[model samples]
Structure formats: structure tokens, C-alpha cells
Target: MAYQTFRQEYLQVPPVTRAYTTACVLTTAAVQLELITPFQLYFNPELIFKHFQIWRLITNYLFFGPVGFNFLFNMIFLYRYCRMLEEGSFRGRTADFVFMFLFGGLLMTLFGLFVNLVFLGQAFTIMLVYVWSRRNPYVRMNFFGLLIFQAPFLPWVLMGFSLLLGNSIIVDLLGIAVGHIYFFLEDVFPNQPGGGRLLRTPSVLKAIFDTPEDDPNYNPLPEERPGGFAWGEGQRLGG
Candidate 1:
């Protein structure tokens, strides 16, 4: 019964978030068990090009350092925010969500070439947090019971916390940067006087991931709820 209950709860997580968090956990477990070396998963242009090791591009974002506090911290944020976004704004829009992932990943990869950073999972988490916060700006937030603020400040608060932890803020900044670009293009710019949608999901991707209207499981909600409150329910400790 206990196993079944656990399984049920696990199955409740959104599909993309579930798959992503599972990959991160399993990747870390593989490294911790000595089944794989960390060197193999890091981003390397030479390995990707000369050696044709394309897996590194994707794997780099799957493994955060070996199972430790930082790993746990990042995983929590990644899973929480990613799931919230998936079930919230991006709900019923699987293809759009996937497009966001592709868009962010592609931008991050391009920027990674100029920066010395590898393993972009942290940055990716920030991007998720950024999008969630922006879409739910009126939602109140409390950080570690010490500070209170609105949703949009979440990313900067996280960057500050990262600075305090002595971890580089560059990754967090990068996530925020890319996230803003996506948000502006997708959400902001499109609403301008003459602006039009810049991020249209490909028809093939939509057909593959989106549910048909006739499907019983298909349900759609307004982009923003009528009330000032956001439908998401979760607690954020810090960052």
C-alpha cells in the first residue's frame, strides 16, 4: 500500500518536470555510484564538434555536482518551479512549454560558448523560476521567513542568496537574462502597439505534444485567472 501511494504521488507530477527531475537525480546517482565520471557530462565544444559527442550538450544540463547540498538545493528549485510552470501557465500547452525549453536551451548553449561555465542545470532552473514569477507577479512570496516580496523578485533574491553561498552568480544571472529575453519576446513585445507574436510553436511540435480538442483529457484555462491570485500552490524557502 505504501509503495502504491508513493507511486501515485510521483505519478501526479507533470510529465516534463517528472522526466527532468528524474534525469537529474539518476545522473547524480550514476556519478555517486561511480558508474560514470563527471568529466563525461560537462559541456565541451571540442568534444561536441571534433569528437561528435553531442550527448554532452544535453547531459551537461542533467547532472548538477554529485549528490550534495548544492545538488539538493538546485533539484528542489528545478522540480518545484518547473512543475509549477508546467501545471500552471503552460498547462494544456505542452508544445509551447517544450518550445520554451528548446528556446532557452539553445540560447544558453550559444552563450555557454563565450562563458567558462559548464553544466547549465542551475541556469535552467533560474529560467523556470523567472517565467513563473513574471506570469504570477501579484502572488505574494516569503523567503526563509526573513524577507517578504512579490513574485518577480524571486530570481534576484536567489542570485543574492547564491552570492552569499559563495557560489558564482553568473549562472543565475545567465538564466535570468535568457528568461527575460524569452518573456519579453513571448509576453511583452507581442503586446506592443505594432508587435506581433515572435515565438510561435511549430505545427509539427504542436501536433505531436498537444492534445486534440476532442480528447477527453483536453482542458484549457484562461491565461490568467480572474482573481489576483495565481492557482499555483507551493512554498519557496530561499532563492
Candidate 2:
């Protein structure tokens, strides 16, 4: 019964979020078990270009190191915000959401080339949180009941928390920059006078990822449901 319940909940997560979180967990587990090493997963431009270790480009974003406080903290935020974005503003828009992921990821990769940063999973999570917060600006949020503010401040609050932990703020800042660029181009500028929709969902992508409406019984799930408000003060660290 417990396994079945867990299966049900797992199936409820949207496809992209489900795949991403699964990959993260599996990658971390592999590292923890000594099956893989961080040296293999970090972003190395020379290795990628010269040695053809191209997998580093994607693997760098999948690892958060062995299980610990940072790993658990990042995973929670990633799962929560990524799921929320998939189920909220991006609802019924799978192709566009996936495009956003690709876009943000490409930008991050470009920026990372110049920075001495590895393991972009934390920054990726921050980007997701930033985009979600921007879209839902009015949503009231609190961090561990100690800090309460609007949704958009969540990313900055997280940056401050990272600072407190003796971690560098560059990753968090990189994420915020990418997220704001996305928001400005896709959401903000497109609505301004003389502005147009520059980020049209490609026809091929729509054809591949979007659901067809011609089918009368193409239910994708137990029915479309909203994500839970799992954020706020009561939630414990590493939860």
C-alpha cells in the first residue's frame, strides 16, 4: 500500500519536473555510492572541447554532490518551484515550458564558460524559483517563519541564506540574472507598446510536446491539478 501510494504521487508530477528530479536524485546517489566522481560531472570547457567529454555540459547541472544539508536544501527548492511552474502558469503549455528550460539552460551554459563555477543545479533551482515568483508576484511567502515577503523576493532571500552558509553568491546571482532576462524578454517586454512576441513556440516543438485537442478522450492524468503550497516558515531544513 505504501509503495502504491508513493507511485501514485510520483505519477502525479508533471513529465519534465518528474524527469529532472529523478535525474538529480539518481546522479547524487551515484556520486554518494562512489560509482561516479564530482570531477567527472563538473563543467570543464577544455575537457569538453578537447577530450570530447561533452556529457559534462549536462551532468554539471545534474549533481549537487553527496547527500548533506546543501543537497537536501537544493532538492527541496528545485522540486517545489519546478513543480509549481509546470502546474501553474505553464499549465497546458508543455512545449513553451520546455523551451523556457532550454533557453535558460543555454544562457547559463554560456555565462558559466567565463566563471569558475561547477555544479549548476543550485543556480538552475534559483532560476526556477525566480521565474515562478515573478509570474506570481502577489503570492505571499515566508521563509522559515522568520522572513515574510512577496513572491519575487524569494530568490534574493535564498541568496542571502546561501551567504550565511559560507557559500558563494555567484551561482544564485547567475540564476537571478538569467531568470530576469527571461522574464523581461518573454513576459515583460512582449506586453509593452511596440513590442511583439519574439519568443514564439516553434511549430516543431508544439507538434512534438503539446497535446492534441482532436482526441476526445486524451486525458493526460487523473485530471489537471494544482501544486500544493509547500513553502513557508513551518517547513524544516532538509525537508
Candidate 3:
């Protein structure tokens, strides 16, 4: 009965979010089971180019260290923001969402070459949080009930929190950089005078994943950005 309930809820998650979160979980579980080592999953440009271990490009973003508080925290934020983005901004636009994934992954992969990050799953999560916060700037949010700020500041707050834990800041910075690039190109630039969309979703992707023909007249649903108010030291960051 418990398994059935879990499966039902899991099946209800949006496709992109479901796939990503599931991949992260399975990768972590595999590591825990000793079926795969982080050494085999982490990013290595040399291995990718020389030996053609192309899977590393993706597996790098699928492991988030051994299961612990950090893993739960990242998974919570990742699932929440990623789902909100898909069901909110990218509603009925699966292909475009996938394209954004491709674009962000590509940019991160290129930048990862110069950085010392092994598993970029946390960074990728930050990127999702950054984009979601930017799109819903008016939303009120609080961090662990100690800090109250607007939505746009959530990413920075997370970075600050990570700093407190003594983790390297490079990962956070990389996420913010890539997220800002995506936000500027997709949301900011197109709205500017005489500026057109620089990141067009490829037709092939559309044909493969989704199509305009799916709906002759499609209206976007409301943004699923979280909104609320609370007092006390809540571990989660939400508004």
C-alpha cells in the first residue's frame, strides 16, 4: 500500500522534473549500493574527449554526494523550483523547457571545464532556484526563518548558507552566472527594444518532444511560484 501511494505521487510529477529528480535519486542510490563510484560519474573532459565517456556529461549532474541533510535540501529545492518552472512558465511547452535544459547544461559544461566542481547537481539546482526566483520577484521568501527577503534574493541566501558550511563558493557562482545568462537571454533581452529572442527552441526538439499543433490556441497557465508568510525557524526556504 505504501509503495502504491508513492508510485502514484511520483507518476504525477511533471515529466521533466520527474525524469531529472528520479535520475538524481537513482544515481545516489546506485552509489550507496556500491554499484557505481563518484569517480565514474564525475565530469572529466579528458575522459569524455579521449575515451568518449559521454555519459559523464550528464551523470555529473545526477549525484549530490552521500545522502544527508545537503542532499535532502537540494532535492527539495530542486523538485519544487523545477516543477514550478515546468508547470508555470513552461506550461505546455515541454520542448522549450528541454531546450533551456540543453542550453544551461551546455553552458555549464563549458564553464565546468575551467572550474573544480565534480558533481554539478547542486549547482544545477541553484540555477533552477535562480530562474524561478527571478521570474517571481515580487514573492516574499524567508530563509530558515532567520532571514526574510524577496524571491530574487533566494539564490544568494543559499550561497551564503553554503558558505557558512565551508563548501567552495565556486559552485554557487557558476550557477548564478549561468542562470543570469539564461534569464537575460530568455526573459530580459526579448522584452527590450528591437531585441529578439536569441535562444530559439529548435524545430527538431519541438517535433520530437512537443508541437504547436498540440494546441491550435494554447493559453499559458498561471505561474506556480510559491507565495505565503510564516514565522519561526523553518529549515525550508519558501514564500
What are the lDDT scores of the predictions, listed in order? 0.83, 0.82, 0.83
Model 3 misplaced stretches (Cα beyond 4 Å): 211-239
* lDDT digits (tens) for residues 1-239 of candidate 3: 99999997777777899999999999999999999999999999999999999999999999999999889878888888898898788877899999989999999999999988888888888898899888877766756567877778888988988999998888999999999999999999999999989999999988888855544443332354353323211223442
Candidate 1: Cα lDDT at 90: 83
Query: Candidate 2 lDDT, tens digit per residue, 1-239?
Result: 99999997898788898999999999989988899999999999899999999999899999987798889888888887788788777777889989998898999999999888987888999999899888876666667657767777889998999999899999999999999999999999989999977878788889988885424443343111212434432221222
Name model 2 segments beyond 4 Å from true.
213-239
Error of 3 at 32 (Å): 0.2
Note the residue pairs that clash in candidate 1: none
Error of 3 at 23 (Å): 0.5
